[model samples]
Target: MTEQPSAAAHAKTQADFAANLASVRERIARAELEAGRTPGSVRLLPVTKTVPSDRLRLAIAAGVEWLGENKVQEALQKSEELADLPHLKYSVIGHLQTNKAKYVARFAHEFQALDNLRQAQALQRRLEAEERTLDVFVQVNTSGEESKFGLDPDDTVAFVKQLPAFDRLQVKGLMTLAIFSTDQIAVRRCFQKLSALRDSVREINPDIKELSMGMSGDFELAIAEGATVVRVGQGIFGARALPDSHYWPGFAH
Candidate 1:
């Protein structure tokens, strides 16, 4: 039989994790404050994509309540296993498939990447069928990448105008993925565009209040451009374990 960790070893492990979380929270505060924004304005969502449920429980014990997952299947499994933890908030941060809308909406507190009207409508229908309301963020392709999945600036406005049709789905402003480059100017431009798009949406509907942008690399720039919710993964969890060659999983790039 395998030997379990001794009580002292477990206590030491927990202490190390607690210290790490406190440091991460402090870093977030510093980053937000550097941009002339209050520390509380930025909410830290530990992106526990491939991490197992045991790690998730450890995180919750260390004071992480909000978590982001990129795949519906992964999130679904973790949700079932971690259902006993009432304080945890799991959000779908991936490119959601239309057919998986019902499962995604079943647990996601916020869906941060609605790219088209079709997807939005599908989500609405699913929510109505399930008799639930979902918070959604319309993603914009600010980087103008052909590989990305978001509305063009013009199309995003039109999508916002049609949001009233999806009464059960709450339109919670915009989410964007900036071009993956280190050029500060380029990053700022993309973020600025998303912020402007958000402004336009708010003009049309006063209730749209979230701007879910930024990741580990460019989150500070995103904050400067008005990202109220930042989805940071590696910055919090450190480098992820490299996957095997044959595993062509949904989010395994």
Candidate 2:
């Protein structure tokens, strides 16, 4: 079993989860206000990558409606385990393999890291067979990082133009993993790039509007740069047993 993030009792308590969730929401709301965005314009995606189903109950209890998972199999297992929970939707926010499209097609309500036609086509086929449409985002690698999984900023326009053929894959927005760094300038630059990329791509596909960027440490900066959705895990679920490299291969080794 993947252990809960911290050894401290406070980390495992319902009161702690509730408090943490409220704090995150307040921060998001504050950022939206500072950015001149309308109230609740920014959506907070509570990332439950390593959180167990038992602890997830606490999060759902505290009013988390959507969960972001990095791996399709892990997301599937949790979905099966939490089947009785009402109205909870899963968003697969990590790099997805073409072979795993069936799993995502059946389980996820949305997929946020789509960068290639092969993956998109695979997902479209599966979704068509499943008789469901999937909301997707074209991921952009704005930081110029080789380890990150996304289309290069220069390639995004051409890439998005091909998405129309995959009707079952509803291109709802854009997603990106900014350079994992404390340098505010570098991080914010990433959000700026994705925001710009979204504007350019919107000309080709008007529905591609949402920008999913930022994480636990830099979401405020992302919001300032026009992030419609932020992916946060440790900020709410304490911490995970594995390091980020486990999910983001070749990053921060």
- Whole-model Cα lDDT per candidate? 0.76, 0.85
Measured against the true structure, the TM-scores of the candidates, in listed sequence, are: 0.88, 0.91
Q: Which ten residues in a row have the lowest lDDT in candidate 1?
A: 1-10
lDDT of 1: 0.76
What is the C-alpha lDDT profile of model 1 across 1-253, one tens digit per residue?
A: 1121111111124455576566656666776787788769887777777766776677678777887988887788778888998777878878888988888768778788888777887888888887889888888999999998888988888878888988887887788899988687898899999988888888899888788887776777788878888776665555666533323265574
Give one digit per residue, the lDDT tens place, for model 2 in 1-253. 1112222223476788888887888888888888999999999898888677888898888878999998887788888889998599999998899999999999899999998989988998999899999999888999998988899899999999888898998898999998977677898899999999899998998888899998878888889899999988878877566534323333221
Model 2 lDDT, full chain set? 0.85
What are the clashing pairs of model 1? none
Q: What residue pairs are clashing in model 2?
A: none
- Which stretches in model 1 have alpha-carbon errors above 4 Å? 1-13, 243-251
Which candidate achieves the best TM-score against the true structure?
Answer: 2
Error of 1 at 22 (Å): 2.5
